[model samples]
Target: MNEITLPPVSEIDWSTWVPEQVATLMFILRNDEVLLIRKKRGLGAGKINGPGGRIEGDETPEECAIRETNEELLINPINTRFGGELFFHAEDMPRIHVHIYVATDFEGTPSETDEAIPIWFKLDQLPFDEMWDDDRIWLGHVLQGGTVEGYFTFIEERLIDQQVIFN
Candidate 1:
């Protein structure tokens, strides 16, 4: 596999790097179905994941989550709660801090956008095999009303080590 080519971890100043390419991801759940997207372009394209993207300057993670949702899925996520955080340490990609959220509801119907195709799956039927490897680390916990925080390091897309906490 071709590696993502991120800056070396040792050079990353995590204390101040949270503003660098910070991202937000939102999962909207209803009944037993969870909304996901099959990205059509950019990072993680062709993979199954929730709707989200980079945080613009002066925008909070929550704002980014709502904005990305409206852009990608044409819905305004409602009752979004901060779920956890993911710190990415990878060789191929730059260090990233991603804020995660779970939306108990949303406004408008999900429609496909230029960036992704929205899809839904049963809570017990998530496509783990088609998502980022780290999804297996915290997805289930947050989906079940629990919270999660994960720090994952990778080399060439292969998981190197992981630390996760759930409550």
Candidate 2:
């Protein structure tokens, strides 16, 4: 297979970058465990990640987060709060901006759905190996209640560069 070529990270103008998709990622935290999903379809299919997707027309990021959680895991996330924002630029696709939220409570049980399967993991034992490379770099800070902003560049599925800032 031919390798895809991407512009170097330093050559991209982050200040003027526009995302083709605006998305949300909602993490449901309960005491020592956090809810994650094994995505079965769409963008990151087969990857383990938070429940989220592209935002619909006029929907606020928080609203999108709750809705996506319900749609993907059959649960309605409650007490959701903004956690951070992530900017992803991949060689083969348009840039994506993801707003992250953390929810402390939820209603209904998490169940398997067409798009994902719900799983709960300990805060300190997140399945980073089964997740995107960037998850390992910044997820810990978010779990510890630090707001973060990250910029990541990828060549297809492999991370090539990143910058993460905790607020």
Candidate 3:
């Protein structure tokens, strides 16, 4: 038997090392509003984002997205479509990648849950200023029907440089 040796902490770029599998709901509300949440934990906790969570167990990312939305905001993600993936890399965390999604429809009214507070925002009223800085750079591009995969270098939680491959 062989033991798998993990990389030394000193070799891991903690500043940019954040590998995550995340699903984001693009729940379009009745009045051209988008359902968003104030996350309670993780990378974007306390900032506005769509309902989602890390992929767990044998569940696929799509399943995780729907389950997370239900668990976090008590909403049923209906007519959900796989919007595709987002791959991000940073120099601080050189060995991890992020997978992101955008879903289209959902059921039930948005409400606050222990993990998040769901709210509806008009299409033009997105609160980009209160979110992670990288969001403003790519989130809009994703919502606008573009596919994205990129690498970024961050220092002290601030992005210093990025390279995106959009399709």
Candidate 4:
């Protein structure tokens, strides 16, 4: 048998550790309206969300945000800024770490795509009832021009426990 030595636990920077799948979300907002999409397929199908998707190899979160926006909305997202991070854990699914960004500068009008249908709503008129369980709890903060960090736990699409903080 061979023996291996490991570094002290304190030497590890666990705070920066990331799970297998990394995702990015970008929200485009104007004075009183924010653009959203009705997802047609994939996780949270039929739910309303900002355009986003899994990050590909070697792609930065910001890069992933731009790519996802273009793919889903056919628009070029500009002046994007990192807004927050979300940690989601589900009993039957892999944990997901999402990097969220807010973009107010963009070109072209949004249109429906194979993945989702573009929609706009007055900020105060957002349809929280038709979004992911955690959205109603935390998304409002993001819409209010604040940063948010959330650790959410879910069981089969139902939120079990969550702690959301806004800056």
Clashing pairs for model 3 are 13-92, 16-92, 16-93, 17-92, 17-93, 78-106
Scored by lDDT, model 4 comes in at: 0.84
Question: Considering only N, C-alpha and C atoms within 3 Å, which residue pairs clash in candidate 4?
Answer: none
Question: Which wins on lDDT, candidate 1 or candidate 4?
Answer: 1
- After aligning candidate 4 to the native by TM-score, how far in Å is the CA of 165 from where it should be? 2.1
For 9-91, candidate 2 gives per-residue lDDT tens digits of 67789899989999999999999999999999988789999999999999999999999999999999998788999999886
The list of candidate 3 runs beyond 4 A from truth reads 1-31, 90-96
lDDT of 4 by residue, 1-167 (tens): 44323333334343885566789989999889999999999988899999999999899999999999999999988988888999876546667989999998899878889998999999999998888889988787887778898877666777777777789
Candidate 4: segments with Cα more than 4 A from true spot: 1-18
Write candidate 3's Cα lDDT for 83-133 as tens digits.
Answer: 545444443433335556665666777678878987777777788887656
How does candidate 2 score on lDDT?
A: 0.91
TM-score for each candidate, following the candidate numbering = 0.88, 0.95, 0.73, 0.87
Score candidate 4 by TM-score against the native.
0.87
Worst 10 residues of 1 by lDDT: 3-12
Q: After superposition, how far is residue 124 of candidate 2 from its true place, in Å?
A: 1.1
Winner on TM-score (1 vs 4): 1
lDDT for model 1: 0.87
lDDT score of residue 94 within candidate 4? 67
After the best TM-score superposition of candidate 1, give how far the Cα of residue 27 lies from its true spot, in angstroms. Answer: 0.2
